[model samples]
Target: MHEMSVALSVVDHVEQAVRPDGAHGVRRVHVEIGELAGVVPDALAFCFELACSGTVLEGAELVTRFLPGRASCAPCGRTWDTGMPPDMTCAACRGGATELLSGRELRITEVHWSAEPAAPDPGPAPHPEESR
Candidate 1:
């Protein structure tokens, strides 16, 4: 699945950024996906989890934000938000010769992590009669 590939890339990038201390782990990954990027969020999340399993990024969350598309019409010389429309027509003059503004990005924006030590477990509680 393409999600698997995307996840791999994400992990690679995060690894480069995180420096991985003894107790540190990737906590979250923020991603920005364009509406026209054709990536299924759920599928990507599923693949990401599978890819990160047993790795330093294990249990980390994947946060995604969708960016809408934009367009500029050549005929009317107007710019507008295409909203990733099916035909990508210019809303201003209904022109087809419009330049796409965005909606073709799949990038990791930021990464969050935690390096806290694991808490120690307390001894079991004493039974009613065991404690004097």
Candidate 2:
């Protein structure tokens, strides 16, 4: 499935973004998917687990936000939700003219890194400290 490739690409990007900043692992990743993007969320989730088997994001949670398909109805003078198959006509007015506004998005928004506990600072030694 194409989901496998998509998941692999996402993992690759997350690793690249985190590895350079002393980050060893990723905790969560936020991905935005649209109804018209033609991506199956279930398939993508399955693929993500398989693709991340040996990657740094192996245990990272794949958080997805689904956006509704929306189109602008010129006759209605407003933007409204259009059912899948992208109904070309406005539901309210039943007009043939309409403008597609969104519902074709597929993007990786951000990645959250696992928080690392701060290292404890050593206290002052018994000997006098040098007054540099």
Candidate 3:
């Protein structure tokens, strides 16, 4: 499925972003998926798991935020939720002229890195006089 490819691409992005900074791996990732993005969340999740096998992103939590599709009619200067429809007319003025404002977004919003505990720093050895 295409979702598998998409998942792999996402993992590539996350790994590239975190690996340069010494991150051991990713703990979580947040992505925004719009109603019109044409991505199936369940399929994506399933593919993600497979794609992440043996990778730094393995077991990383995938948080998805669903955004509603929105469009605005230029003639009436009106905006409304477009739901899942491919095309819509202005509800206020019955105008067919419209431009999409939001939706069709499939992007990563944030990434959380696995927290590795820092090594403890030993203070300087006691002075010779104090030791005596």
Candidate 4:
């Protein structure tokens, strides 16, 4: 499925972004996907796991947020939600000409890194006089 390719791309991108900063691994990845993007969230998640094998993103959580499909009618200047199998025709004016405002998008919005914890701060060295 195309989801596999998409997942691989996500892993590559996450690695590219975090590796430069010395990040040890990725904990989570937040992605925005439109309803009309033609991607199945479950499939993407499964593919993500496969793609991440042997990579820093292995076992990383994939969080997906769905965006509604919206369209604007050119004739009536009206906007409405065009659910799956989007109806491009304007509902208000029954106009055939319309422009898609949103949806059909797949993108990575955020990445949480699994970084190493900082070492505890050591107290100042003991004074020589105190040691004596």
lDDT, each prediction:
0.80, 0.80, 0.82, 0.88
- Please provide, for model 3 over 38-68, each residue's C-alpha lDDT reduced to its tens digit, 9 standing for 90 to 100: 8899999888878877777777878899998
- Give me the candidate number with maximum lDDT: 4
| Regions of model 2 farther than 4 Å from truth | 18-20, 115-132
Which run of 10 residues does model 3 get worst, by summed lDDT? Answer: 114-123
The better-scoring model by TM-score among 3 and 4 is 4
Better of 1 and 4 by lDDT: 4
TM-score of each: 0.76, 0.77, 0.81, 0.82
Q: Of the candidates numbered 2 and 4, which has the greater TM-score value?
A: 4
For model 4 the TM-score comes to 0.82
Give the winner by TM-score.
4
- Colliding residue pairs in candidate 4: none
Candidate 3 wrong stretches, greater than 4 Å: 18-22, 116-132
